[model samples]
Target: MNSTHDTSRHIGVHIDRPVQEVYAYTSDPTNLPAWARGLAGAVEKVGDQWVATASALGRVVVSFAPPNEFGVLDHDVTLPSGVTIYNPLRVIADGTGSEVVFTLRRQPEMTDAEFERDAGAVADDLARLRDLLESEG
Candidate 1:
């Protein structure tokens, strides 16, 4: 499925850490359970793919973008029912801190209220990530 054609919401949070630090942590799927409670319960690697026991979708395969210096953290989530969702995420440098952005897309059949709730969940997750990272500093 093409995510660009779907409705999307961009939510972000400012972390009191360097971009590299935030990117390194967030880009690792294993860390999703710590911050993204709405998305994952636990993430583990099976063969070449990373599988997460997601709170919303159960067990799903997750594939992240290749590591680069630009702080891109995009990933693809494939559900057990054979649906794939593309997520666009980024970590950007802001002074000595960093900004993490997550683009949440609405499924084609989702209602307006559902979309809003999903965005809110993403916002909450970002806040959790911010709090988790900042608290460690």
Candidate 2:
């Protein structure tokens, strides 16, 4: 099978900490809002999962993981134009800091502006994570 990064989106940030430390924090669903400022409030728990709200999308439940992989359930979220998309988030450690990758295939369609916005959000989150980890160390 093709690697997820082949067709999916990718972003990375290098925190001045051990890979294990960054991975532990990023892989925890509850700490997502700490890095992703767009999340309005604390993530809501469903069953045993926690839901993270994306800026343009509604609630997204991230699956539980220890340190390496973190994923959000693929589900349709409406856009302003009434279009929908199923976006799944994949996060892992790269050397030291964590790398966050998102997989999105157009449902109605995809736009450069939308992709840019999403990419910007991801980048900002990673930058914040790096800053926080480094400062704490």
Candidate 3:
């Protein structure tokens, strides 16, 4: 496998809240700061685009897919270097609870260690999301 090729890691968590609730909470970019620490805790809309003011990747533009009843929460994060990263996410019904899954894509330029770190960050974010939803619901 070429080290410069892209890959992905699927990180997920189970929240005691309903799938609809989980989808509603996470699909809103404004609620990101409370759970996703990777954004450095701030985001705002710049005209039509949602921009994260501070992040490990610096200020980035985030664009999400149109809301639907299928629990799709895919988004694109455009980094400072003009690189756009696609993130795939979903909130699925699991009996009375829900399962949130985030697919972290490994950039072609990222080293092995960097990819692992990004994966870890994603796991942490999902864990936080679980805590927030399960506790507050």
Question: Tens digits of per-residue lDDT for model 1 on 49-74?
Answer: 99899767899999999999999989
Q: Residue by residue across 1-137, what tens digits does model 3's lDDT show?
A: 22654477788898999899999999999998899888647989889999886656789999999999999999988889998988899999999999999988877767888888888888998999999988896
lDDT of 2 by residue, 1-137 (tens): 23323244656555667766766666555776777675424566778656667654565554443333343323333444455445555545566555555454423244656656666776787788778778889
| TM-score of every candidate relative to the true structure | 0.92, 0.63, 0.92
lDDT, ranked from best to worst: 1, 3, 2
Error of 1 at 102 (Å): 0.8
lDDT of 1: 0.88
Per-model C-alpha lDDT, please?
A: 0.88, 0.57, 0.87
Error of 1 at 28 (Å): 1.7
Candidate 1, after superposition: displacement of residue 42 in Å?
A: 0.8
